[model samples]
Target: MKNAAVMHPKDRPEGSEHNECRALGQILDRVGDKWTIMVVGVLSRGPFRFNQLMREIGGVSHRMLTLTLRSLERDGLVSRTAYATIPPKVEYALTDAGRSLIEPLRILSNWAIEFRPVIEKARAEFDSRQV
Candidate 1:
């Protein structure tokens, strides 16, 4: 009854499209790092210095945090500033693009937190069945 000759993309508009492959790869690189998500969440509240970030994100090593921040800065998601102060203060802040990702991250975190009990139970059952 149907002549299905064309296989059009269902999710994209006829003329409007994007580089989804590149976008997915870059996004995965961002969220793939646990510390990056934590750092983004921390900075979403506002800017903070190196020490403040260290304090906010518990258990994050100086090296790892520095690396994560550098990655984010390179990706244009975060901006870093340095001041010629007595202690030579440096601070980190999120760009507009980074700020826009906060809601999605919050949603992801909430889902993980809210589903923890169910997820744990499922894992337990799965492990027991495998035994």
Candidate 2:
């Protein structure tokens, strides 16, 4: 199926596209990535600087964080604010629609926890079969 981003309504925000499949891919691209969801989950609390996001998300490389943030911003789920200063000031926060994702993420979290054993078993089986 086409990604929702590409087929989304024409009235969508500037950074957002109008194709349904493109939009779907954009969403999956954001949440399906381990780091993007974590970033959004953490940012749901409030805005944070890039370094702060890195600290909060943990184990994420600077490049990956940058990529994730850029993609999220492009998808209209996250916004970037910049301030002029000696070193420059920047922060990331969720848009209202991005905020709406928190509840669904919570549900996904619950599902991950509940099905972890099954998932792990399947993972191990698949890994072993590949050997």
Candidate 3:
């Protein structure tokens, strides 16, 4: 008896492409997040302490920044280092993998900047049509 969980890949209709897309979607969900993008952009400059990151990124709440850092760390894109001192200090920096993301992100950023007026005009047209 073949268990559904153990079913062969040949048994699946969507096959490997579906699985590949699902994996890509999960990664996109992480990297495509606004906070993640902002954090990555700031970190690309250099390492930053927690408070420094908050100040530099602006508008990120304490908890949100903490969560975003944790998520980035979990994905191995960012590294966290702690120092022993009277007041313990920690800093966050990008790993090589994270650094590799900068070029693609920069291209995407440039594209968005270039198309902003066009997008805004399209949105206005769409909104007017909806009325």
Q: Please, what is the TM-score per model?
A: 0.79, 0.74, 0.87
Over 1-131, each residue of candidate 2 has an lDDT whose tens digit, in order, gives 45534555654665555355586886687677898789988999999999999998899999999999998998888999999997999989999988989999999999999999999999999999999
Cα error, residue 15 of model 3, in Å, equals 3.8
lDDT of 2: 0.87
Candidate closer to the true structure by TM-score (higher is better), 1 or 3: 3
From the highest lDDT down, the ranking of the candidates is: 3, 2, 1
Candidate 2: Cα lDDT at 13: 60
Compare the candidates by TM-score and give the number of the best one. Answer: 3
Candidate 3 residues 33-61, lDDT tens each?
99999999999999999999999999999
Model 3: per-residue Cα lDDT at residue 47 = 98
Error (Å) of candidate 3 at residue 93 is 0.3
Model 3 steric clash pairs: none
| Candidate 2 ranges beyond 4 A from true positions | 1-23, 122-131
lDDT of 1 by residue, 7-70 (tens): 3456455433355556777788787679989999899999999889999999999999999999
